[model samples]
Target: MQSISSQTSKPEWLSSNLLLQPFLWAMSWLDYILAPLQNLIGYKRMAYFFVLPNLLIFGIFILIPMLLNFYYGFTGGDSILLENRPVVGAANFEKIFSCQDFFKPNTCAEDLFWRGAWNTLTFVVFQVAFIILMSLITALALNRDVRGRGFFRAIFFYPVLLSPVVVALIWKWILQYQNGLLNAFLVSLGLTKVPWLLDANWAQFWVIAVSVWAQMGFFTLILLAGLQGIPKEMYEAASMDGANKWRSFWNVTLPLLMPTMTVVLVLALIRAVQVFDQVFVLTNGGPGTATLYIVQYIYRTAFEFRNYGMAAAASLVLAVVLLILTIGQLLFQRRQEAA
Candidate 1:
């Protein structure tokens, strides 16, 4: 195939005005500015400039904060903050590991924060797994040929699009003690109020359940797109080999869905680690720090306690952990791809 060359291509105005007017030396500088602008905005990717202002804003707001966070991680004092800092040289890192406040705490003389770590891990593993599975199932169901499919899919994905605060507030109202909608309904049905958010176990359950409800819809939509792109003939071929629905799904569907699953897994992992807003709104790491995630702790450390340096150090450590986990997943994915 003969390819068109992008180089040596001059606009009609430039070719006519510059070439024919050989005596116009003063106008040459005009070409320097106008030529590039014309090429950029004339007809090729001109809309990209619309994002230029956003890009600048993001650089100032997000990028600058990120850079400052990284810089603060290495420094000893809380340079940008005022509290519990006096240039103590890697003392924070040592404290992060050794301190009884987090990663290890002695509430019952048995380490309460370590217990909280287990609680966080349980939430991460079970909540993420349940949400992913539910989402995948919803996606598969929606991808099928059915009546009112669009309506059903939209209903499922609507909760995900809502702001976290709004969703949390809604859940809060529903899951509140005796006056809550959920408890009221249950009590009306001859059941006692369930204390959904007050009890420790109930709080964890509601947090996970609410999180899954919000999360499943979006992942379903994503996985549904991946599912719809798959050729139907592949499933038919597997069926011809006497494969059942389960076998076809496992053998044909799942293997082809690896790329989508990989994306879902990594995104879920990242979100799981950074779970804060829902936990904050729903549990406030409460009933006694039962729902406190690593992020929630960091948030308290930085803003609540004003321990910015330690918080920065914790944030840096988290970034490193997430990076390593992402890289590890990518390596595994590459191996699967190769195989």
Candidate 2:
């Protein structure tokens, strides 16, 4: 009996020892290197030493690229190499803005850019509004004491884990005009087949809807956390005052959830502005540039058109817009906190 028990335990002990040995050996080397550094820097400043690697990485990958992009925007040439390009001042921006009228895209020198800008604006407005509403509704429903709540939450969140390409491909398959699932279902119900992606109006609508559906889960989770953080006693007090569910939600929940909502709003806006991958895969900015957002415009200009300077200019404009949005969010949050 003792020999049998020893045999069974041997594998488990050996497996743990194998894992532990490598990890312990690595940690000992880390300690040995860090000890000298720690002594040289002092404990209080050791934090900065540890952070130096991340700062270096950020400078190399992010900061340098951003500066180069800014410089590229001022240049004009066929070549992407900065040194080969000639300085063109604000010619690209002037071209983009050169129009008989601001509202008339056809009048502009860079009419495609204007078209993309308008489409992006429309998409952002509708998409952001729908995302906020749907996520809030879903979060509220999931927050309730319902059976299979955890299962349902996971189901809703599953799409967020999917790659943008995968999401587009799945929907593209489902919405195919010939022999698609949705069209087949409609035909079965004795309804006429709709050209979901072929028509400009339908294509634009579905793009926004698909974008909202894909992103709603992440925002829902954020709002759910905010909802969970609210003190239960507030709701109890509201009930004691004879407030109904609607009244309680309006007075208590909305106020407390504003911060989270602001976060979701700004994040959704930024993502919506940068929307390209899924829409590109799904629509390819087709049906007459109806779904051509700014990012896609920049992409086509750079790679397809081989106009690197124009693409860089457009990207700089986009970056400025994003920076403004970020700063606005920070200011809003500061004011909210102060209040």
Candidate 3:
């Protein structure tokens, strides 16, 4: 051993250069923190082992990134500056409002963004209303002891289960201008073939309709669960008081299911306003900018135009708007609860 040690100039510390340093240190830290408990209980009694990893993961993946995004939102970011860039307050936001599409001839006649914003709001407003009402009806219908209730539930849920892209593709086929299923069926019934995706008006309508179709299943399922939770005694009591179906729904059912309904409406509104992917696949926000949602515009601004700061700023604005809506919903719900 002396001869072998003398033969090499290598240091003794390098012999145990194991890759387990971090783990060993971590376990040692754990032991030090929990050493007092070892006298009173077992190793499993200390929840640190279970707790530390989850806390570590949450901090690393969620909390840190959320904090950074908030920071980035304020940073006047450029794709060239990449990360941790300097702040240029309010410039990004101003750009979005002031951007004039001067390159496009005849586009001057219309206020592009104001008009696009109008269309987006209309889509969101109508779609959310339709989805909530339709979902409620579907939930009520499926809540009964009718024949093949399970099958009907599955059928409703089926559209929601399909990938958004797949749903979009399916709807596209159905709504195709010439040989589409919809037009073919219309012709068979001695009706005219209609342009579903080619016209601005019709395109807007289908975008909303298909979105409602794809989403209704999931919302229906949610409301159905809420409906089931209402006690049968409530219905019987209402009936004993001579309330009809509509009256019972408006009074007993509505108030009792308000909590779930509140959640459904708020979520649906957020989703509807940020509508993309389905619209992306089905119409790409056009025939014109008829279905061009705010998100798509931001996406194009950021990635397509390499205006990272503007994109980030737009997203922050969208987030703020959504937060405001959510707060409104919460306040309304509180008022409802108080009433």
Which predicted model would earn the best lDDT? Answer: 2
Over 66-150, each residue of candidate 1 has an lDDT whose tens digit, in order, gives 8977656655654465344456667666666675455446632324335555676789898889989899888888888899998
The weakest ten consecutive residues by lDDT in model 1 span: 107-116
How good is model 1 by TM-score?
A: 0.77
Question: Model 2: per-residue lDDT, tens digit, 75-125?
Answer: 898898878999999998888879998787999899999999999999999
RMSD (Å) of each candidate, 1 decimal: 8.6, 6.3, 13.2
Q: Give RMSD (Å) of candidate 1 vs. truth.
A: 8.6
Q: Rate the local accuracy (lDDT) of all candidates.
A: 0.79, 0.93, 0.82
Judge candidate 2 at residue 106 and give its lDDT: 91
Clashing pairs in 3: none
Q: Assess candidate 3 and give its TM-score to the true structure.
A: 0.77
TM-score of each: 0.77, 0.90, 0.77
